[model samples]
Target: MSILATEIWENRFFNGQWAVAEKNYAVTEVATGDQLGVMGYAQPSDVEYSAQQAKVAQEKWWALSYQERAQIFENAIQVAIDHKADIIEWLIKESGSIVMKASFETDLAIQALKNAMILPSSVQGSVLPTQNGKLSLAKRLPLGVVGVISPFNFPLYLAIRAVAPALALGNAVVLKPDERTAVCSGFVIARIFELAGLPKGLLHVLPGGAEVGEALVNDPNIASIQFTGSTEVGRIIGAGAGRTLKKVSLELGGKNSLLILDDADIELASQNIAWGVFLHSGQICMTSGKILIHQSIFEKVKQRVVEKVQQLKMGNPMDPSVNIGPLINQRQCQRVEGLVQSAITAGAKLEVGGKANGVFFEPTVLSQVTQDNPIFEQEIFGPVAVLMPFATDEEAIALANMGDYGLSAGIITSNVSHGMQVAQSLKVGLLHINDQTVNDEILNPFGGFGASGNGTRIGGPANVDEFTQWQWMTIQAQAPNYPF
Candidate 1:
């Protein structure tokens, strides 16, 4: 039986139990507008209570042996695998993800859990040398409680990236998944951990609106905040967390680029561009926002990309044949439509798609897009690709660096050394050579620069730094004789 069919699907997980809240939010299927069920809607007071309980739970959790804590994650990996079908269904229905994308997200979440299994053993303290006759050491300790705010796009993967590490490092987590994807993003995770025998009160799942998020950021009991969403919301969270001097990590928006150099394979470059721009309807943060092609083969690359875009299928994601799915909601559809219309009005040629039917938007391709066009400057989180021409490598680099966001960029060329030189000049935090912009690995450091993030990296070794604090300790055989 699916977990959603049981009582576990109806309530929030907090205070070590699944409890119904005073308010509830309807969970609807984004593709079909069908109501799946309702989830507990957290108020500010609920957030406050969760934070208080999380702090209490963290103390006991941190005292456990590393092996004991690691067992829970090992169990979680199996539990997640056992329920993979239900998880993928929830993602496809609740988050508007295609079947392939949902499966990929589920795999990523499981991979994150697998990676976290090593964290308990990987955390090591260093012995330091001191001038005085004393034993000195630097140790990493958990940050009591971590507050996570995940977005609707890649909810499962984004939430697990932080939640798994924070818990593996002996910290309690209070997660606020976007209300729209509460089932797959928040409730499903709680269910997995609960089945895996995680100690009570160590993880809290709260789904709500801005009020809940603000309370999570402001709660005194929360030691740190991890957020992944739009740059606009990230700025607010950063400011609010700053007032209280809390550690915060923001993986915000991205206006990523894909550069097709003069020496590139046109077919391979075009294939990557289509995949990067249209995957998950381009809802990914690292989705290619700009496509810079060398002027010598600009038209050839554009023709290939347009042909690929026109072939993509957009509709309900439950069907395996559908490559593109609906936007998360009506607001997002309108927002994308508005951007496309505005760009078209601004003299950007809409080569293929500029139409929308209900929530499903066609794969769009635009040429002659100049910097002055809104589509060129903005991070359009839609299946829209804007193509621009560049004269030289320097011009291509300048075009890639034009936006405020410096998240991720990709370069494709037969000349590997030339691609490396261009990659170095780009301002993005993550760069790929001979690959597309939207890429991730469990062991790689995932983050961005400038408006894309606040200089915090997540994944692999970076998790040890993000989820723990460093403390220096000194000890001596006897109290050193000091002048009284």
Candidate 2:
């Protein structure tokens, strides 16, 4: 759909069915985004058949009670967990991610699905107490068909985040997964849905790129669109969906920051920073973008961080010992390298990584970076981190909040009041005190404010609200004492 962005997946669903997929994407390199795969599209009959499946399934899918819907999600979670090893392998080959990343992302997906299984309670909305015989009731009802568009990074996790909820709400979904990671995630998740005994077509997976995505998002059958990826593309899809007045949930890009206070633990800070910055090549929206250190511990923190980063093993992701992997493709490596070079050109010091040799770039760090640097303002969806020293808490807060993207930020301080202050002051959706900003619990609700995108994907009672819309049903009694 997006030129040369294609994946080859075996069609298990259509083996005995009426239609079959001819190709996955536009045909391109698996990791580097170089054109390599065959430029093929699904047969027209396949697309039409899939849509018809969704259309027909929506009726039965929507008719299920909340617990019945949730049961399917719970079973899907079990299926995902049971197939973790196989899915991890697929993630490595298809998504260009480290095994550790695959494990975590898989875990995130399983948790989300598990959470989606217990949301009948979330669907219940309390009635506003009123006098007389007049009655007012509020409840959450499913959107008939949800169109889910997921990005390449954290493919399984993001898709599960979107799909689990839509299913839990008794809504059928048409998922358009990113081409690169389609096979491992799309195939695995779809299988989970089937094993869960979910009604067919309720969780249909369309393993194609932008063209397939455009078809689903534009279709009248799709009642909502939930997306995660770049801000530029997110805006385009979000705007287009808005024209149709479709309910949209988007988790775009972010330039998150992590601050180290003068009285913080350097050891803990450095270890956490290494995990937050280098893991996944920094290809996470919630990953720490800026490292703001207090002047007292600035040099100490820098030395420790550099030492830790240098020790990280950068190699093929299939190796269990490798801590870091290549950027999604050569193009992403180039983009991140360009940003580092630009920062150095702007007088920032490239303390660690400033150049790229191939698809792999060193887990890099840039020091003395200013607010004006593009590296600070833009989301570097690569393993690049910028570090700066702050004179005071006020300066730290100012530096941390300088970016247009406010997704998540972390502060390494044990002080409760200081932690609360920073959390309240910053404009981010999630804040972690004495921990990495990327922390997520299955019980927690995950979303962002500002440019990082709207709405959230997580497993919890609150997340069920995202899957359904609130409706107010009023009934008038025969004799009413309250004004009607």
Candidate 3:
């Protein structure tokens, strides 16, 4: 049976096997608001049951040899490759992703899966120097069952970033994807793993609302939590998980900046700015919320950006020519609309586009934006670009740093050395020189600082730290002797 079929609701993966839910939630296409299908709604008791099953299954999964575990991810990668077309289709329909964005996201998901194949062997332990007749060592072990709660934007890549690594590192996972993107974020993953020959009970997918998320966080059987969403919700999850002393990794929101210095190639800088502010309709957490340009070339850069923004066609994601698609939903569209209007009302000039037809908000660019403007520091997670001018490099850095979010930032300049120095001054976690902020590689430590995240880095070696706990062990040929 095809996982994307409407009948999938009756076979949603839960605990060890496919099970039907007593209740269901309708999933809809973001672009059209048409019903795609329904998914099982997990109650608190269902979350508890899933966690218990994951706990039991984790031990069995851990017993597999590293090679054995790696093979499963290899198979899963192949499975994903085979289903690439279906994956892209669902991403377009289910997540309002244009062809270009959906293709990029699908490729990233496959790359993330390929990266996980190495994690089982990449983790290393350390030997500590010990006194005579004693040997000591430290080893990393999986954190029993990991609870993953992912959001709607970049649903596939964000969810896989945590899920693949956690499972490859020997921990079971109970995933709670946002109800809005259940098919692409949760069911597609579940289907891929199932076809890859992953042992039953190791992975459970539960798509539901806030109550289910709260249940996952508060469940005792869940040893750690990996979450990717807004800062507001991240704070709530962090606080709730802290009470149980459970480890939590929160990849939250961002109000990133793209700094265009005087020496930067205008063509290159303008291109990067357009991509940073408008890619995925600027819905990415790493999206450039502010475009800071040097006073000498601010107008030139702004004009170029506006030209690019104006050329972008917004419509149904299924159309290959469409560069931008609808915002995730009406609620999100209204939130973006409010922010753009508030900025304009606060003396910011609307440069090119500032209109909305339902969920299809025009790609907007604003200039003469002051710090007091609500959009200046807030994450306008839409295709709206706020422009600011600065006289000196120090002033540019200061302007970029004037936000509570320290997630991602980019600096475009011919002077590489100067760009490096300026980048270092910004408090953001990820930095790009001569590139846009919306960049990610499986090897990079993909996370943010401060309100963006709680100092939890994902990807590459960071996964070992996020998904496992360290244990210190001592050994002797016989019993240890103590002065008693």
Candidate 4:
């Protein structure tokens, strides 16, 4: 049952005469344990170049104008868009995300590519407010051969989110995608870029898992690193980068929070609450982890939230009626189940959905949860929510900001003053008042604070700069201070 994707062949201008080496395809349905296609192995696959070789390639790349580099990346984005169906289908099969979610992933990737392209031209630096007549200007430039590490969830989106921008900024990219999701990334785009006529080594997909990742991180020629995954791994990689003084960008783990004040509209609150916790079966790093409700409306809102989460249709990714899909794999399912089981044994009541249903872990929302339970402090990456009661606006804010993983926080309230106060009070990078911190847009800066992430995602200007070096040049009019 191999799905054959027609690989486009460009005018192969790199090796003198025109040639053709079309990208092969393989589709493995991870959920069903079905291997649908043969693996496409390049003849010269997983080949490594010396530090000097990498530098030589990088120098040639960095010498190009930003506009030229941006155009090349733009072509690659077009190639991506043309094969949207293949990419989305493969994502659904490999990642076990609902088709709707996978479709959104593809669309978001398109916007991200557009966003990523802009960085090449917009990696600007501010001129320091100099009192003297000095030509002081700072500019951000590429960090040569950039290393990118991606996770299984949203593999294409996260990988290219960094790769597109890094490539546009005249940096060669060596991508190391998650092992389970590597083939999709490795062969999926290899043909696309080949079709787009991107020079070899400008963007290469390295296969394998942790060892491959470690190799990339340790590579001296690799000037920078971009990563998206667990907080523990992010810390280890960040530490590794520090030793070598390499630039690093990370979007790590999150135990997000959501607050519901007394005055919030019940229907709207419940609707948003459902999305807050259940989106992508709550596997998203920014999915609301702890949900605090005002005691005055706790009973009423808790019931509504429970009912809403229960009503959600959980099934196969291909089913249009499915609102939630399976976990990435069995291990994740067990980990999520373990957290809830511990909480239940410790006396937390399962108000609505707690039992595992099929590949889908029932949209589990546990009530009466407190810090006494392990799930309270842990990052249970599943479709679960804890409805804790709060007395005052200050208490709600306090409860919301209590966690160390401050990636995102949500609030549902009509009072502008309270909304602003909570928004200002939270320690998270993104605070959505009257809304859940989900459905991330491509134009916004997506990142975290505290232990969640090391900085920004691909949607913002900050992300592009994180992978670059800020160089300054100044010619002072009055240089009488001290000539070194």
Candidate 5:
């Protein structure tokens, strides 16, 4: 058993209070397989109870002025700032994130909260031209309660990515953080909001596995759903939300492409590509799975990338010098290993590290990956990347679009005009110029195209659209005459 496991898992956050669960499940560290602690296991009935409480709390919360709601979110920023070090430590232990990656996630979550605070001022409605003696206006209203399902890879940021905005928009929230990192995200996040003076029942954190997730999705009280995870799981959540006629926002999977045009600066391109593919071991939705290099620069770029991967330090994430960390679990490590082995069996050449020891996978690079290989077509959520040569600009774009997922894509070119043109042609919701695919901003619209997500975006002023409904109101002193 992990020493921290018993200490951390003694209680679970429920309806803004720390309490024991009906059952407990063990959480282990990925690198050493040591018990970190046991977290609460929420049953289906607990899901129903949470939804009912959220609905009740939302009525009172929604009645407050937008400025009032914004003030509460502003308080959250201070809470996050004050607890930064502790939260980062929890993230590293619970999610197997390196020191830098953990710090980045914690900072991003705080920034998102700040962005959420400002968004209420932007949630404005419009007045329509009147044909009759009537006052007409279209105003946005909260969707009542929101259900947030976040992944373990970015347990804190992904959860707050939706939760902060939903709260700002006057809706209550029921959050289901991934089972693996529930202690930090579930318990600690609830503490952050409570410390910020959010009303009880307005936000409920349920740290659970698939059963809890399924129950939350099926509950009638949840008005909308926001999910970030694998495309396979997103599909199920989307379908369930559809059946319920509930609004759904999905930030799903991605096989993002990093295009190295012939005119690109080799050194700069290699550096960005290395960061994009190896950051957090490439467990992010926007991580570049495919490195599409111009045929003229393929060998040069590949050599630099392989050299960069070789230099990356892979060990305990707690070490500031370690550039890479373990996968979320043994299963993920095995999956990544299996994919690398299968890719090699299908004739792909492994140029660098392709092995796993315990839960740690070495930074791996592959060449000669064919279209038929899964590694080329799917999201290999690991520190693994494949380099492929493209003969022409059209071929490069074609290769980038070959996959069904298109959350993010980027091009590196010295020519700004060419980069802009290619960026316009790409189908992803987010496009980068002279940068890698791994980029995000709190105030920018964040989502993807096709299998990557639904059309709804989750960040910036657009957040209001995902968590609220537009209702047009008209009032007339005298009833208007109909055609009759």
Candidate 6:
């Protein structure tokens, strides 16, 4: 039975209903390069319509009581839970996520939706102290209509990371999911909300390419924009949002680093870091592309990394045994190949795995990578890892911070105190002590610094702040005497 043969598999949802697109875009499976499904390519008019409908629905959605909003989210969570198997199937087929990755992401998405239930009750106004017996208070209000642009990687998790919060905070959402994972991210997401009783026009899902994304972003009715994708595209959205004076939040690119201190357990670091680099074939934004190892244990760590890479099984995502799956598309596979080749030309040693077959690229490891190498600077978002040695703690920190990206960084050390110290010195927004760079929790603020993104964080209680605005209210207990 094909996953896409069903009516709910490849369609657009708008105004609380589903419709097929006039033109169908064929979706290819990353592993086999076969037609997995066909998704509707939303037209510019459709995008505009989503925005207009969202605006019309925002008022009514906002008027709902917090309990009502929370109930909807609660129902939505149940819907996600009920459709878990289908979501996982679509994730594997469309996003090329291995079993563990698909399952983890599905659970994360469900948890995010469940955690968002806190928003309705947790969102509170602040009472400010005023002088001369004046009453001042500030209320956190929804941003009206939130425009969410999500990436193909971790489609369900990333989409709901924004959508759940925006809807929970009383704002209508217009979601533009990446075309590659339209089935899971677009249609399934809409179905979940629809079944959860989200009102008509309050939630819209349009899956298309760049034109559809641009239309959604440029829509004047969209009150704010939330995006997760490459840093280059994030820059454009940031600039456009700036010109329009619209509030925006971005979770962008990362060439994150993983540092192995001299006292680290090489075997454990290798075992854990392999998951970081190879999970989803390194498609995650926080996947560590660079590794800085202390010169003392550099050789041991490098050998262990090679061994770990060798252990990864790349094949169909549905197979429980496969650890690494295919990249999202052939272009990305080629880009990873090109980056690895460029590094090799620059004198970096390819320790293991550097070949690409169809959409599947071997999990590669490179050593002696210099700062001049493209892999050292550019984000090769594939199952490729680069290892470099540093003589001292300062040198390692310098190498880790010597990049345009500062999204996430990891410090692996036996000494907890030392790891904490190193973590504090790093420039990235999120740091993991004795863990991989690719770490996320629904209850924590997740985002990056510098070229990685604007400092605005998402998730946790911060999401409410990002998707809402502060409005001040004042009352005069007594009329003030003024000379007019």
Which candidate number has the best TM-score?
Answer: 1
Worst 10 residues of 4 by lDDT: 8-17
Each prediction's TM-score versus the true structure: 0.98, 0.89, 0.98, 0.88, 0.96, 0.96
Question: Which segments of model 6 are wrong by more than 4 Å?
Answer: 1-5, 9-15, 131-133, 477-481
Report RMSD for candidate 3.
1.3
Cα lDDT tens digits for candidate 6, 397-419: 89999888999999899999999
RMSD of 6: 1.8
In angstroms, give how far residue 21 of model 4 lies from its true place.
Answer: 17
Give the Cα RMSD of candidate 1: 1.0
Model 5 poorest ten-residue lDDT run: 1-10
**lDDT (Cα, tens digit) per residue for candidate 2, span 1-484:** 2111133233332211213445535433334554433322443344445666776787886676767776776677777777777777667767878887888887888878777777643636768676677678887778887878888878888888777777776677777777666665565677677667877666667666566667766777778888888888888888888888888887888888898887788898888788888878888888888888888888888899888888888877878898888777788889888888888888888778666768888888888888877677877878877888999888888988886677899988868677777777888888888888777676767777777886655445556666788889877757546876
Cα lDDT of model 5 by residue, 75-161, tens digit: 989988988888888888889999998999899999989888887777368898887778999998899989998898888888898
- Model 5 residue runs over 4 Å out of place are 1-9, 481-484
Put down candidate 1 lDDT per residue, 234-340, tens digits, no spaces.
Answer: 99999999999999999999999999999999999999999999999999999999999999999999999999987888889999899999998878888899999
User: Once superposed on the true structure, which residue ranges of model 1 sit more than 4 Å away at CA?
Assistant: 11-13
Backbone collision tally, model 3:
0
Summarize candidate 4's per-residue lDDT along 286-352 as a digit string, tens digits.
8888888888888888889887876788777777688888887777787788888899998789887
lDDT of 3 by residue, 136-203 (tens): 99998999999999988899998988999999999999999988888898888998898899999999
Candidate no. 1 TM-score: 0.98
Q: List the residue pairs that clash in candidate 1.
A: none
**Model with the higher lDDT, candidate 4 or 5:** 5
Clashing pairs in 5: 5-36, 5-37
Under the 3 Å rule for N, CA and C atoms, how many clashes does model 1 have? 0
Whichever of 1 and 2 has more TM-score, that candidate is 1
User: Residue 235 in candidate 4 has what lDDT?
Assistant: 91
Model 2: residues with Cα > 4 Å off, grouped in runs: 1-18, 24-52, 65-67, 120-123, 455-459, 476-484
lDDT of 5: 0.87
Give the distance in Å from residue 218's predicted Cα in candidate 1 to where it truly belongs. 0.7
Error of 1 at 286 (Å): 0.2
